[model samples]
Target: MERIEVIFKQIGTALRIIFLYKIVFLIACFSITTGWAKTITVCNTCDIASLKKAIAVAEAEDTIFIKKGTYKEFNIVVDKPLTIKGENFPVIDGEDQGEIIRITSDNVTIDGLFIINVGTSYTSDHAAIRVVKSEKFLIQNVVLEKLFFGIYLEKSNNGKVYHNKIIGDAQDEYNSGNGIQLWYCKNVIVGRNIVQKTRDGIYLEFSDNITIDNNISTENLRYGLHFMFSNDDVYTNNTFENNGAGVAVMFSKRIKMLNNTFHKNWGTAAFGLLLKEINDAEISGNTFEENTVGINIEGSNRITYHKNNFIRNGYAIKVLGACYTNVFEYNNFLYNSFDISYNSRINDNVFANNYWSSYTGYDLDRDGIGDIPYRPVKLFSYIVNRTPETIILMRSLFIDIIDFSEKVSPVFTPDNLVDERPKMKKIK
Candidate 1:
């Protein structure tokens, strides 16, 4: 039969090459869902003379509308999935030649821009807006000034940097700039921003599940919000003032500091919030005003300082030690010159039911909770904790008669670290 007619002509040429590969994969998915994303407008009477020549003749969901001019242009590369508008705020000048807008692509978009000269490298990290190795991106209402790094987010992931206004007149931390940086990024969503005099107004190093909400980081020269080794992050209602030590949560792990506002952050080693080696944190409803040191807990341990409010601080909490088992409940220790400063007295932490406006304990039968037991670890704070030069005679009178005889014989400060149940008021 002539070899059965050559095996039916090789099965009819394998069904005509599988029907022409399903008609070329359905016309490349119908040319990417029928449109390939259009809208490519640019003014001063033109179509594509600039804006990186309409992003090299746009494609991936195109849209590069630029109207108002001033484009001295630099290294702009929006690899695809585009949408780069600028109807009135277009001024992307990077004549300094470095990074003005270098997004590697993935659903990109940048609104009303104003990125300025950003090129002062010491090996390179230039940016006005650099979202390298991109993922879902969308940087809104941008206005990054004379920057060396602003709105930078390398190795990105689900991004959405909103309402950006990153100012950077950086002077120190090695030649400035960092108003919105997230390295090794993750689920990011830095919202409602307003960063000042840059140098970390919103920085996160090993970013993870980030969500810095309602931001208003002020006068920055260092840390208005500098997150290190980030982990499961979340800082709500933020307002870290006077920067230079306002908010530094280092070596993190499962943190969630809420309702933030740590004021002033004065010098000579300022701090209104600095908890190193933190772990399992949950500092709630925060507000540590007039800062000098209103929360500088080091070598942190199992943390949870709830319902916070510590005003007039020069020192409202400075606990350093091989800290263990932390938990200071229902806080509010107003009017501080020094409310608690421990170095160690061999004690575990648990300052309960707080509310100490200089507790002089006495609420007998008051039913509200203060049946005596307030001792917030003082005794000239254990002689400034073993002679920190005796803190300049902590207001003489022989250091208040040895802190009133260690508050009437309790010997060197940690008599079971009391605070038993002293909240007979103030929780508002």
Candidate 2:
């Protein structure tokens, strides 16, 4: 019995030693991962003055804090998981040499830096900040100016670009680049960024599952928000104003655009929102005001436009054919020149429970809906679609007479295209 007790004591001692070794090993790993992380300061008087030198000497997960000064550097590459933060908005001037900062590492954060003067190269898309093939990255509170492409995310996923201001002096589309561009990226959130005067304010190609929210994109040389071949994207509470073309979504599916404002995007060829070959999208509670065309849809299907306000647009909704299974319900078309313009006489879409300012039907039953069906498309609109020069006589009495006569008997407009439940008052 004493020998057995001695043996059990020996076993317990061995287990205790193994557990102690494991605890020590875990401590060593914790030190390598987090406890040994240090901060490197960058300034003119500091030991590591240049950002490139600081990044080169930084260990993994170290922080590089840049002080307030102008550092003329370009082609700065971050190849490790590090935090590059600035105090009082340090300026990193690329001096028109090349790309400012390129992050090729995951779990990196770039915060509160002012980057400028990205080189203009037709061969390459030089960016103020570029995240390439990295995941779990964050770029916030960065100000970028004089850029070719501002904040370009290339094949990066699970990133957040927040509260950045990107402004460019792009004169021509061929020579300039987009302000914020996501190429082949997925699961990204671009929020609260103000981009202006660039080729396109924000552009996405082959990017999926992106959330673009509360961004103010205006005065771009091209579309304010343009995406193609992207799926499952959400754009909410964004303002697109005075762009060449406000927004364009093409060949995308399952997009949700809600509560956005498209205002003052005016040109002969410009539109507030252009949808081409889009499918299964939801557009709700948006306001399109004073645009040349409110929504220009072509080859789009299975879209739901609900509770939107189209105010004083040249053409509220212009369908250029091949649009089917789309529903426009509870919308307010207020004082648009032409409510709906269709090129084809065949109609497969439904327009129900909308309020039109030009609806002349009365409600004798005292309900909110009108008694008679409202014909939204006019013959003069069809004529203007064919002959653009005839828009000069839009307010003339001759045009009104022809429109009245066509309303009496449907000749050019689709005969079955009528709102059966037109609202007497504008939808709130």
Candidate 3:
């Protein structure tokens, strides 16, 4: 007609200017995401005075979704960058003078709560999610039963204490405490938590680049994980069971303990890992099972104990007194009543190609080694080193007739503490 109605009015004015420039770029991204959408919803039949007046009129990227009963009120103070969730798991009964969630907020997130009476102290570290001087915080799936110190991170940093469940019916460590206590924190990442009957189920002092992996620190009244002077850390695959001494790394240094599982730390100054004054360390593939002493290296220096798996311990590796230049290679000293316990009868440490489930030498022409020399310090460990009541006749037969007459004349232990390439069997 008239040039097809002027090409349909010039393609309808270029499709209405491309639909008004995509509706003004979607209203400028919904006004920059509704300017950080603030949300506040609390109702367990409402009225804890209107849920503390909707968390005191929330702000800074707000979110206060607290809908589940038992908010028996205590000193609830959360200073800003909010997000105080608790869809269910809401019980903050702090009837013990103050503290029941006192976060001084940077980017806060105190999820699913339940914090019981925690007000004790000679100086007050009363907690149940108490992060003072906060930074990027996140205390996940919370549950802190009848506590004093359960998730107390003072002077916080880039934090992330995940999957929390801290129960502390702690009977005397002089009035229980510490389930996840970190002081002067740093870039922390404590994962998969389950800290029990506390008095120490994860206590780190002077914390640094911490990374405690896959945790399940059991039965605690002490040392389920106690780190002093903490340093560049990385404790992997954790499971420090039957506590009271299953993990303690004092005066720490560059530590990297992989595949961890330090078991039952039994009495008499128990130890399933107590490396005091540690230096450049690396204890790989760990699994010191039935422990009563399976790694108690003192004044550690240049440490390195590879491929570890010292099962059934009653003293598997106790090198007391100023230890130096440590190295025990290809380890697997199973069924240990005493594989290596040196109180310094002088043997500058190094037990090669180890695998001594009581290695009785002789591999003849089979080349898998052990044609003798596998003397891992017995002789009833020198009669329990001068009768600690002779260790209940350790593997009897009069301690195997004086450990086979001190393994053919090498009297009273540490005769160059051998393990010469001894792997004729049990390397499992």
Candidate 4:
């Protein structure tokens, strides 16, 4: 019985030793597979000559290097997790055929590529690079020109799009698309991009928790940055200039726009910033320069506008209707034709501690605050709202006399609309 027990113990020891060796072998194989991942090179003279062929044979988490040459490819779908890096800004011309690159998988990175000529289609929203339902993606250092839609993100999240240049030649709105558009996306960072001459430079629809900073969007056919139903988004240090309508924030809540520059957006319906149906937002430290209207507000409520500089605009702030509980303080309204134009006679908004360049009131006590209340709404502006043709008499002396009379007696404009504590000097 003792000899039988010894044989059984020897068999158990051998089985344990075999199991340990098998585990070590499996770990070693995994390490080799991870450390020696394949890199497919695509060029005119290479084993993998085309991007499509390289992607077809590439394993998961492989790297694909594209050489510096024009690859006329369209509808190139990236359905696997890979890294595509360009050697010297390789051109990916779509030949005006269709969509350029579509990414459907997660954990993808595309860098240093110049994509152009995305075909225009009324039925399909083609894009230079469309990231659809992907996560943990990075699309950076890319240049897109003559495209329909540049970097369109649809239902994608956790992505970064940085340092991309999108220059579109859009003549009209119907035939054009947006530069950087995010639809139903979240947790995305769009920074350091230059988008010009598109329908809308940066457009967000139903997107949340987005950060758009350090971007220059100018010369677009429509609004430079257009937000619709997007909430909890912050856009700071961006420049929107010379667009059809500068920046339109509509139907959005809890949005913060800080330290942005809106300049030189002039048209019949142009404005530096248009807020329609927006609520609970903050606009601070912004500059509105040389725009037709500094801000065109309509049906917005509970917004705070502070420390903004409105310079040389046609109307500094045009309050159309149904805007209430809006606070405007520490703002510099300089050289505006009309400081504030109110369409309604009832005023529930607050405007205080603002520096008006046209304020002629003298401070006897020299406390840097005007003792007399400054009425910003003018009767001539009210008449101009009714009859836009009367704007020709804006600089006439007769128009000034009527505006002065309306200030003394609150008949045509809102009586309660006054800046009681107006600043004597310009706001720094």
Candidate 5:
């Protein structure tokens, strides 16, 4: 019995020794396969002075730390996974030649770089930084100036663009490009960016599942934020101000726009928000102040506009035609030239629980609901739509008399468009 016990103990000891050897062998193989990632410094007096040279010799998953100096290089391609970091925001002056950086590999990050003077080309859209078909990429804390297109993302997904400032000196829309453009991208987040003076501040085309939050888009020559054929996107807490037009969401469905401010976007053909061919959208908690038109709707259906404040606008909500099943509830319309303007006599929308500053109806029930229904559509607005020159007499007593008569017996505007449960006070 003693001899058998010794034999079993020796067998167990041999198995333990073999397991330890296997672990050591696996560690050696891993070390050989993935060499340690190293940092390559680029400076004027360093061995690698130029950014192109640093990138040429860099292995995958390496860090290229560029010191503070001007690098006059263009069309620099990043074809491997590398983090190109700049200290004190190094300047990459393209000298009006071509694109500054083009990222084509996955898991690449471009941080703390100031890029300028991207080439202008009518045939191709030149950009300061362009990410093409890259995934898991990050572009943050970068400044772009004097660029044709500031940061362009083409067919890229699962990326983030954060805290970048893009300033352009765009004079015309025909020759200028957008600040940050996303084409055919999905699952991208654009946050905390300030884009100004571009043709369009931020433009998205054919992109889906995008989150655009906390962005300030101002002073653009065209729309501050333009969306075309992009669906299932949400833009929240953004401020669009002083642009030619605030925002245009066209041919998109299932969009959620919440807590955004649109202010001072005034022009003859300007509006705070334009919705065309949009469906199943939610627009809530927005403030539109001092704009030509607060919201312009055309051929949109199944949208909900709730908890919005439209103050001191030329027209609060202008319904062109073919808008159906839309609900405007719990909104405050204050001191507008015209509260609602409908070009069509047919209305299939619901207006409920809204507060109008011009409402004279009494609330006898004391339940915070007005006793009488308020009709928002005025006859003068309809006349002005047909003969825009008649808008000159908007404040005249003659226009007021005609508007009172139409309220009694509606003829030009949609008769069914009345807030049944009008709120006595403004919604908080």
Candidate 6:
């Protein structure tokens, strides 16, 4: 009977210990969900003078407010879920040491800070801010300058980068990095950012489901916006101007490029837009102006070019090879040196209902369409393809005679490559 009494006493102690554990867990969860989350302030005269120290003692869901001062720190890592905000635009100077702020946790937020002087490394991609393998992160209202890379997201998902300005004084492409770069990231929204003088203003590789909207990327050494191996991305209301080769989309599929402007991208090899090996894309309502070549397409297929305006370019569209099933319709080609240049003799793409300023055909019945078919590819363009130095005689009367002869006999240019229903008036 004494042994039975001892066994019952042991059972009672175990039950009491379990009850105490439940109470402790409930209190810890309540601190996170209720109003128990703390706010830590970092200032020059405070107890926590350093941002690194405030992050050290901060709990999950705490906010760290940084006051107005210059903090000479680098390699600061945020490994917990916290909100870091600057009160009066505090400056975080990296002194060209390394990456400034690196976030490795989910639900992290960084806002209203000015970061500069990121270290340049050939082996490592140092950035002013780097978010790696994190989800639902927000980096907004920051300014970055003198950067190797401004904001880089690697393997991150469901993030938003908004209202940031990144300025880089990049002279060459060998050492310069992109302003905003995403690698293997998905479902990211990048908006209202101004990026200039980087290698490529905004770059993406192996990323998907990204929306890049309302951004201005210009004056870079390479492309203003570039993407490769990315799919299901949408870029709208962006302006890409004065870059080396404006924008290049290679090896991508299902991309929607709408309502963007590509202007003043001029060089010997520069173009407003370059599409290489891309398929099933939509290029609509965009403006390509004053470029050497408006759009250079190579090995791209099934893209719909609709309602775009190509103005004052050397060649409005230059097709290299293996481009098939692409539809060009309802677009305006105005004051271009050449409307279209095709290298191959076979014509597999469709060009219909486009307005050409060089079209001299008459509409006899006034049905809002030209009665004669418009041959976009001229024979001089074919000769310029073989001998580029012959472009000096582009405006001479001799070149015009040969182009008319080729139109009459259909010798060098593709005979079937003609717009049957050319629009009599410009497309609105």
Best by lDDT: 2
lDDT of each: 0.86, 0.96, 0.83, 0.94, 0.95, 0.95
- Expressed as tens digits, the lDDT of each residue in 10-52 for candidate 4 is 9999999999999999988997877656788899788877788
Off by over 4 Å in 6: 1-35
Query: Higher-TM-score candidate among 1 and 6?
Result: 6
**Which 10 successive residues of model 6 have the least lDDT summed?**
29-38
Q: What are the clash counts of all predictions, listed in order?
A: 0, 0, 0, 0, 0, 0
Error of 2 at 363 (Å): 0.3
**Positional deviation of 109 in candidate 4, in angstroms?**
0.9
The residue ranges of model 5 lying beyond 4 angstroms of the native Cα positions read: 1-33
Whole-structure CA lDDT of model 3: 0.83
lDDT of 4 at 230: 100
Q: Name the runs in model 4 displaced over 4 angstroms.
A: 1-30
Q: Give the alpha carbon lDDT tens digit for every residue of 10-117 in model 3.
A: 999999999999999998899787875567887767553334566688877788888777766766778887888887787877877756778897888989887888
Candidate 2 runs further than 4 Å off:
1-35
Candidate 1 structure, TM-score to reference: 0.44
* Ten-residue region with minimum lDDT total, candidate 5: 29-38
Collision pairs in model 4:
none
RMSD of each: 13.8, 6.3, 14.8, 7.0, 5.6, 9.0
